[model samples]
Target chain A: MIQQLNDSTSEAIQQLNDSTKMFNLYLKLGFEHLLDLAAYDHLLFVIALTVVYQLAEWKKLLILVTAFTIGHSITLALAVLDVIQFPATIIEWLIPITILLTAAYNLWTLSATDGDSATQKTDLNIKYFAALFFGLIHGMGFSNFLKSALMPGEEQQIVWQLLAFNLGIEMGQLVIVGMVVLINFLVLNFLKVNKQNWIKIVNTLVMVFCIWIIGGLLE
Target chain B: MIFFLQILSLWLAHDIHLTKAQVDVNTSEQSVQVSMHIFLDDLEKVIQEETGFTEKMHLGTEKEVPEGDSLLAVYLRSHFLITANEEPLSFSFVGKENSQDLLAVWCYFEFPLSDISTKKLTLTNNVLMELYNDQQNIITLVGPNKKRDYLLFQVDEATASFSY
Candidate 1:
C-alpha cells in the first residue's frame, strides 16, 4: 500500500510540475513591467539639485543637466554590459554623499562672500559647475537604479526601458526645478524680506540631514 | 569607513542561503525529523573582484538595530517568501553549528502524514510537501536519515502546505 501511494504521489507531483512549467512559460512571454517606482536616491538627486540652485541660469543649467545625462547614460550602458560594476551597498552610500557634497559646496560659496551682488553672481556660476560635476556622480547613481530594473535575460528590452526611464527622470527633474524656482520667486524675491541669511541657514540644515542619511545608508 | 565596515560585517556574519534541498519519508510508528541546510555567504568578494571598484567609504555614525533581532530577519522577511499555509513563517537563527556555517530555522505545523517525498530544493526554486488535509492531526517521527535529511515534513491540516 505504501509503495503504491508513493508511486501515485510522484505521478501527481510530475503532472503539477508539467502544468506549472507551461504556466510559467506563458507568464515570461508577456510584457513584464520592469520599471518600479523610482528609487529614493533618484528622488533625492532631483531634490538636492532644486534646493541648491535658487537663482536659475537657464543656459548653464541646461549644459550641466546634459552633462549629467551623458555621464549616467555611459555608465549605465557600461555597467549593464558587465564592463563596470560596484558593490550595491557602496553605491547606496555614495548616492547620499553626492547630495551632501553638493549642499556643502552651496553653503561654502554662499558663506564665503558678503552681501555683494557681484559675489553672489560669481558664486552662482561656481554652483553651476559644481552641479555639473555632481550630476556625473548622480548619473552613476541613476544607472544603478536602472540596472536593477533591467534584468540579464531581458537584454533586448534594456535600450527601450533605459530611454523611457531617462526620459521620465528628465521630466521629474524639470518639474522639481520649476517648483523650486516658483517657490523662490514667490517667497524670497517677491516678498523681498532680505532672507539671504535664512536661505544659507536652510541649505546648511539640508546638508546636515544629507550627512545623517548617508551615515545611515553606510551602516 | 567604519560605517561601511559595519554594514559589510553584518552582511558577512549572517548566512544567506541561495539554494537548499530536502526529502522526507514516514511510517505510522516513527516521529517526524526535519533536516534542512541552506547555502549562504557574503558574495562581496566576488562582486568586488569582478567589479574593480571599492564600496563607498562611509564616515557616518552607526545605526542601531531598530528591533531586537539582527537586520537579517527583516531582510529575509521582505525579500524571501517563507510561509505556512497562507501566513508568513517566522524564522529564528539557530546559530552556526556542526562545521556547516549554516543557520538553521525551525517551525512546526499540525498535520499527520504516513510518508512524504520531495524533489531537490534550491533557493531559486523550492519544493514543499505537506501531508494530511484535516485539522488537529498529530505527527511524530524519529531521527532523520542523514543522507537525505534536508527535507522537512509537517502534518498539520490547518497549516500544512506545499509549493514548487
Candidate 2:
C-alpha cells in the first residue's frame, strides 16, 4: 500500500511537469513566431502600425494592439479548429498587402491631412477598426504555422496550447511596440528629428518594403 | 536603400526552419511508427551539403531526383535514432508524401519490436540542426498504454527518453 501511494504521487507530479512543459513550449513557439526573421510579414505589420504613434499615446496604442489581437485570436481559433480553411499562398500574399495598406494610410494621414481634434478622433477610430480587420487576415497566416506544428491525437490539450501560444504572441508584439516607442523617443528628443518627418520616413520605408514583398509574391 | 536591398536579398533565400515528428508505439502490434514533417528546400540544401549531391533534387516535384528516397533514408539513418530498453533499434523508411501546400514532405518510418513492453524509449532527432541555428524539431511520442510525451529538440539538446 505504501508503494502504491508513492507510485501515485510520483505519477501526479510527472503529469503536472508534463503539462507545464507543454505550456511553456507553445508559449515560446508563439513568441518566436513574431521574432523569426524569415516570417517577417507579421513583424513588418507591427512596425507599420506602430510608427505613426508617439510614446505619449501608449494607452491608445495598447488598445489598438489589443483590438488587433482579439480579431486575430478569433480567426486563429476558428482556423485551428478546422472550421475554416484557405490556401496558404493566398494568406501569405494577403499579409504583405495588409502591411502595404497600413503604411499608405500612415503616409496619407501624416502628409495630406490637417488634423483638427475632431477629425483626428475619427481617424483614430478608423485606424482601430482597420487594425482589427487586418488582424483577421494575419490570424489565418498564423494558423498555418500552428496547424503545421500540431501533433496528431493531441486534440485534448489544444485549448491550453492555443491560449498559451496566443499569449506569447501578444507579449512578443508588445515588446516590438516598446522598442519602436523607445526609438521614437530617443530620435525625437536627443537627435532632434522632426516628429512628422520621422513618421513619414518610416512609413515610406515600410511602403517600399511591402511593395517588394508583394512584387515577389506576384512573380 | 542599401540596407533595404540587403535585407530583401536575405529574405528571398530564407523561410522558417521547423520540423515536427510523431512517434506512436503500438503494444499490441509490437511496433513503433515515426512520421516527420520537413521542408523540401531545407532538405535539399542539407542533403547537398552532407552528401555532395550537386544536382537539383527538385524534391516533391515532378522532376524529382531518382535517388531522392535513398538519399533521404541515409540522411535519416544518420541523424535520427531510436533506442528501446537501452538498445538501439533500427527503423526502415516506409514512405513519404507531399504536404498539402507542397512546400514540405512528411516521411514515415517503422521500427518492429520483439518485445511488446519497453521499459525505456529514447529518441535522438537532430535533423537540420547543423544548418540553422534557429532550427527546432518538435517530437510527440506516444508510448505503451497510451502514455504521451512531448519534447522540443534544439541544436544544443537533441535527445530525450521516456521511462514506462
Candidate 3:
C-alpha cells in the first residue's frame, strides 16, 4: 500500500518556495504582455490613461492605477474562466473606442482648473472611477494572451495566478506612467514649457492615435 | 483579437501536438524532481471521471475534496512509474504549482537516494492519455557528470530507459 504522500510538514515548508516561483513566472508574463509590440493597442491605452497625470501627484496616480488594476482583474478572471463569455469581436472594437473616449475626455477637460484644490479633489474622484470602468474593457482586450499563456490548474491556483499576472501588468503600467510623469516634470518645470500648451500637445497626439485605431478597426 | 489562436489550441491539444510534462534528475543529490503540467479544465474532467468524485477540486483554495490528494497521488503514481537499476522506486509527493502562462497545474514529485554509483533508470508517464489521444510527456534525465538524455513518450508507448 502506498503511504500518505503529501506530508503536512512538507507542504508547509514548500509553500514559500512554491509561491515565489508562482509570482516570478506570472509576473514576468504580465510585464511582457504590456511591453509586447503586438500588444501596442494595450501600451497606447495605458499611455492615454496616464498622459494627463504628473509624477508629483504620486498619491492620486497610485489610487487611479489601483482602481484600473481591480477593474481589469475582475473581468479577466470572469472571461478567462468561461463564466462570462462575451464575443471577443465586440471587445476588440471597443478597446480602440475606449482609448478614443479617454483621450477625448482629456481634451474636453483640458481647461478644468487644476489650481483649485476643491476642483482637483472632485476631478480626481471622477477620474479614479473612470479608470476603473474603462479598465474592464481593457481587461477583455488582455484576456486572449492571458488565456493562451496560462496553464489551467486548480481553482485556487488559477485565482492566485490571475492576481499575480494582474499585479505584473500593473507593474509594467506603473513604469510607463512613471516615465510620462517624469518627462512632464522636466518639460514643464525645468524646460519652462507652458503647462497648458504641453498638456494640449500630448493629448492631441494621443487623440490622433486613437482615431487611427478606430478607423482601422472599422475597416 | 484574432480567433485563429483559440481554435488552434483546441485542435492541437486534441491532436496531441501541445500538452506537455517534464522531469529532471539530480545525480549529486541522489534525487529527482518531477513536474507534470495539465490544463485545469482537462485535468478536472479526468479527475472527476476516473475517481467518480462529484465535488470539484479547487487548486489553491480551502474548498474541501475529501481524499482528493490521496486520489490524485494514486493516479499520479499509477501513471508515472519510476525504476532504478530495474528495481521499482516509490516517489515522495512534493508539492504543486499553477502557471497562468501554461493554463496548467504542475504537481511536484521527487525520489531520494544515498549516492549515485550508477545512473540507469526507467520512467513511465501516461498522464492524461485516457482523455487526450495525442498527449505527449517529455522526460529529461540528467547525470552527475552534467550529461543529459531525453525521451519523448507518446500514446501506447509511454516508457523509456536512460543510461547516464
Candidate 4:
C-alpha cells in the first residue's frame, strides 16, 4: 500500500513538472514569434495601429489590442484543433494585406478634417472591429508556426500550450505597442513634430513597405 | 563587422530558427527512434558552411547533391548525442523525407540498445545553435505505455535527461 501511494505521489509530481515546462516552451515561442525582427509584418501592423493614437490614448489602444488578442486566440485554438481550414499560402498573403489596409485607413483619417467629434467616434468603433477581424487572420498565420512545433498524438496538451502561447503573444504585442507610444511621445513633445505630419510619415512608410512585401509575394 | 554581417544575413534570410525532434523509446525492439524536422534552407546553409561546399544543396529536389546526405550525417553525429545509463549509444542515420509543405525535411535515425526498458537517457541536441543566437530545439519523448515528456533546448542549455 505504501509503495503504491509513493508511486502515485511521484507520478503527480512528474506531471506537474511536465506541464510547467510545456507552458514555458510555448510561451517563449509565441513571444519570440512576434518579436522576431526577421519577420516584422506583425510588428508593422502593431505600430500602424498605435501611430494613429497619441500617447495619452494608450488605454484605449490597450483595449483595442486586447480585443485583438481575444480574437486571435479563438481562431488559433479553432484552426489548430482542425475546426477550421485555410490554405497557408493564402493566409500569408492576407497578413500583409491587413497591414496595408490599416495604413491606408490611417491615411484616409489624416485626409479628413481633424475636429469632427462624430467622425472620431465612428472611426474608433470601426478600428476596434477592424483590429479584432485582423487578429483572426493573424491567428491563422500563427497556427502555421505552432503546428510546426506540435508532435503527433499529443493533442490533449494543446489547451495549456494555446493559453501560454496567446499570453506570450499578448506580452510581446504590449512591448511593441509601448515602444511605439514612447517614440511617438518623444517625437511630438521633444522633436516638436506636428501630429498630422507624424501620422502621415509613419503611415506612408508602412504602406510602402507593405507594397514591397506584396510584390515579393507575387514574385 | 563580420559578426554584424552574419546576424544581418540570418535575420534577412528566415523568419524563425527552430527544429522539432521526436524521440520514441521502443522497449520491445530494445532501440530508440528519432525523427527530426528542420527547415530546408537552414540545413542547407549550415551544411554548406561546415563542409565548405559552396553550391546549393537543393535538398528534397531532383537536383539534390549526392553529398547532401553524408554532410548532414556528419553534422548530426557531432551535434546530436544520446546516452543510456551514462553509456554512449551511437545512432545510424536511416533516411530523410521532405515535409508535404516542403518548408522543412524530416530526418530519421535509430539507436539500437541491448535493453532500453529501464535506463536513464540523456540527450545533447545543439543543432543549428552555432548559426542563430535564438535557435531552439524542441524534443518530445514518447516512452513505454504512451507516457510523454516535452523538452526545450536552446543555445545556453542544450541537454535534457529522461528515465523509463
Candidate 5:
C-alpha cells in the first residue's frame, strides 16, 4: 500500500511538471500580440500618407513605401544584433518632428499652387527621403521594444522568438496598410468629395496633432 | 518664497544615518560586538524612569542574533532614526578594527540631529513615518517587541528617555 501511494505521488508530481512546461511554452508563443500592439505609430503615419494619395503618382508612392521598408528593415536587423543603440528620448522627439515636417511640406505646396496645372507639377521627392530617414528611427524604437520583451539569455530560443515577433510586426503593418488603401478607394469612388480639400484638412490636422505631441515631450 | 520655505523645512527636518560597516556570512569571525550610544538628552522622562536602574541593557530576548550579515542589517534598522520626505540621504558602512564592539552605529543627518522636531507617530496621530519597501509599496508595521529599546521624547518639556 505504501509503494502504491508513493507511485501515485510521483505521477502527480510529473503531471504538475508537464503543466508548468506547457504554460512556459504558451508564454513564449503568446508574445506575438505584444509585437502587433507596438505598431501604434503606423496609425498616424498612414493617416499622414492619406493626404498625399491624390497628389503622388502611383509609381512614386510605391518607391517611397519601399524605401521606408528597406531603411527600417536594415536598422531593425542591425539594432537587434547590438551593432547600434540610439537614445530613446531623441528618437521619441524626432518621430513627431518628422510628421510635422511632412505636414508643413504638404501645406506649403497646396498654398503656393493655384491651378490644377501648378498643383500637378509640385513634387514630393523631399518628403519621401524624410520618410526613409524617420523609418530608421522608428525601427530602432521597435528593436528596443523587442529587446526588453525577449530579455535574450544564452538560450537559442530567444533568437527564434525575436524573429517571430518581427514577422508579426510586418504582418500587422501590412494589414493596416491594406485597410487604409481599401478605405481610400471606397471614399474616392462613392463619396465624391474634392480630394484636394480633403488633403488640406487632413494635413492641417496632422500638423496640429504633431505639435501637441512635441509640446508633451518638451514638458 | 514657497520653494525656499520648503527647502528650509526639509533641511531642518530630515534624519539620515550613514553606514559604519558591513559583514558577509563567509567572512564573519566567530563573534562580533555591536554598540550604540544613546545620548541621555534625546530620551523622554518615562523611558529614563524605566531603564535607569541598569548601566547595560541587553534586549535580545529571543537569544537569536541574526546570522552573519543579517546582524548588520538588523542593527542599521534598529539604531537609525529617519522622518519621511525631508531630503535625500545616503549611507555608507565603513570597516574599522574596534576591540570593544563588533558593530558600531555613527549617524549624521543632513541637518543637525538636535534640530529634529518630535511629532507623535501613533496610527491615530497626524504625523507619522510611513516606511516603504524597495518596490515603493508601503511596509506594514508589526507589533513592537517589548525587548527592543525605544528612544522616547517629550517635545513640550524638551526631555527624552530610553526604555526597553
Candidate 6:
C-alpha cells in the first residue's frame, strides 16, 4: 500500500506537465498513414484519383484533392473531438471496399470518355463531387487509426495534433503524386507509350491490388 | 527526395494500441491467474496522469513511487475488479514481464478463489478508460482443455460477466 501511494503521487505530477511528445507523435502517425506499404489502401486511393489528370490541369487537381482532404479531416476531427463510437471491425471491412469502388469508378469514367473530348468536362465534374463523399468515408477509415492514438492526449491538444497529423498525411500524399507524375512523364513522353495502353496498365494493376486486399481481408 | 520520405516513415510503427487480459481458472489450484498485456508507453502515460510521477518509468526499472508506492499495482487495483458468482473477488498483484519490442508487457495478478465449479464471474475492467475514450480490453478465459470464452470491453461498456 505504501508503494502504491508513491506511484500515484509521481504520476499525478507528470499529468500536470504537458509535453510536446504527443504533438510529434501524432504528426509522425499522419505521415505513416500515407506511406506505410504494409497497408496501401490510402496510397491506392490517391493514385486512382490522380492517374487521369495531367499536370497541366494543376488547378482542377488541387481543387479535387483539397475536397478529399477536407472531407476526411472533418471526420477525423469528429472522431477525436466527439469520441463518436462506431464498430471498428465494420470500418476495417469497408476501407478495402472503398478502394475497390474508387478504382472501378475510374475504369468506368475512362470508358465513358473513350475518344470523346466533349464529354470529358461532365465526367470530371462528377469525379470532383465524388471525391468529397469518398473523402468522408476515407476520413472515417482514418478515424479508426486516430482513435487508437487519441488517448492520454489532452482533448484540446488533439485538435492541434490532428492538424499536424493531417498536414503530415498531405505531405506524404504529395510525394506519391510526384512519383505518379514522374512515371507518367517517363512512360508517355519518353518511352513513347500509347495513352490507352498506359491507362489500361495502371488501372488494371490497381484493380488487381483491390482484389488482393479484398481477398486478404475476407480471409 | 524519396530517400527523405523513407526516412520520415519507417521511423517506428510503435503505434498506440489496445490491451489484452487472459484469465485462466485452474479448478485444481483454486485460483485464477490474470495476465494482462498493455503497452508500456501508454500505461506510463495513464500512470503519469493519475499520479504526479515525472520520472522515466520503464519496465524492469521499478522504483518506489514518489510517495513510496507501487504504481502499477495501485493503478490496476482501482480499475480492475472481479466478482465471482455475483460476489466480488479481489486481485493481488503477482509480477510482470516486459517484451523488448517497444513497451508491451504482461502483468500478472491473481484471484485466490477460482475453483470455478459451475460459478459465474463478472469483471469490471476500466484499465485505460480515463486516458483513452476508445480503450479496448480483451479478456479470454481458458479451461483445462476445451473450454474458452472471450469478452470485449470498450470505454462505454466496462463490465463482462462470464459463467462456465
Candidate 6 lDDT over B1-164, as tens digits, reads 86454333223322434677778777777777798878776788888788777777654445534432278888888889888777777779888886443346778888878445646778899998898665667666665432455566777789977665
TM-score for candidate 1, please give it. Answer: 0.46
- lDDT (Cα, tens digit) per residue for candidate 5, span A1-219: 999999889768755653443334323322332223322344566457544663235576666666666666667667877788775556676667767777777777775545566455545556567668867866775665544333212234445544555555556555555665666666666886566676677788888877776665555
User: Which stretches in model 2 have alpha-carbon errors above 4 Å?
Assistant: A1-13, A111-114, B1-16, B24-33, B54-66, B81-92, B97-103, B110-124, B129-133, B143-147, B155-164
Q: How many angstroms is residue B41 displaced in model 1 relative to the true structure, after the best TM-score fit?
A: 13
RMSD of 1: 15.3
Q: Tens-digit lDDT track for model 4 on B2-65?
A: 6565334433333457899899999888888999999888898888888899988888777899
Model 1, stretches more than 4 Å misplaced?
A1-40, A52-56, A111-128, A190-195, B1-164
Off by over 4 Å in 6: A1-21, A114-118, B1-164
Number of clashing residue pairs, candidate 2 = 0
| Candidate 5 global lDDT | 0.42
DockQ of 3: 0.04
Off by over 4 Å in 5: A1-39, A54-59, A111-124, A154-159, B1-164
Comparing to the true complex, what docking class would candidate 2 get? acceptable
TM for every model, in the order presented, reads 0.46, 0.82, 0.55, 0.82, 0.45, 0.55
Per-residue accuracy of model 3 over B1-164 as CA lDDT, tens digit each? 33466434433331112244445667666787777665666766677788788887764335636675676776687778888887777778877676643446678888775456657778888878887665555554455544444455667788888666
Q: Which ten contiguous residues of candidate 4 chain A have the minimum total lDDT?
A: A109-118
Steric clash count of candidate 6 = 23
Q: Supply the DockQ value of model 4.
A: 0.26
Query: Which regions in candidate 3 have their CA more than 4 angstroms from the true location?
Result: A1-19, A114-122, A152-156, B1-164
Query: In order, what fnat does every candidate score?
Result: 0.00, 0.31, 0.00, 0.31, 0.00, 0.03
User: How much is the lDDT of residue A167 in candidate 4?
Assistant: 84
Interface RMSD of 1: 12.3
| Candidate 3 chain A, run of 10 with poorest lDDT | A147-156
Candidate 3 local lDDT, A26-130, one digit each (tens): 676677667655446778777777777787667877888888888888889898777897656677777777777777777777777565778777777888888
Query: TM-score for the second chain in candidate 4?
Result: 0.88
In order of listing, the candidates' clash counts read: 17, 0, 18, 0, 6, 23
Deviation from native of the Cα of residue B39 in model 1, angstroms = 15
In order, the Cα lDDT scores of the candidates are: 0.43, 0.84, 0.69, 0.84, 0.42, 0.72
Name the weakest run of 10 consecutive residues (lDDT summed) in model 6 chain A.
A14-23
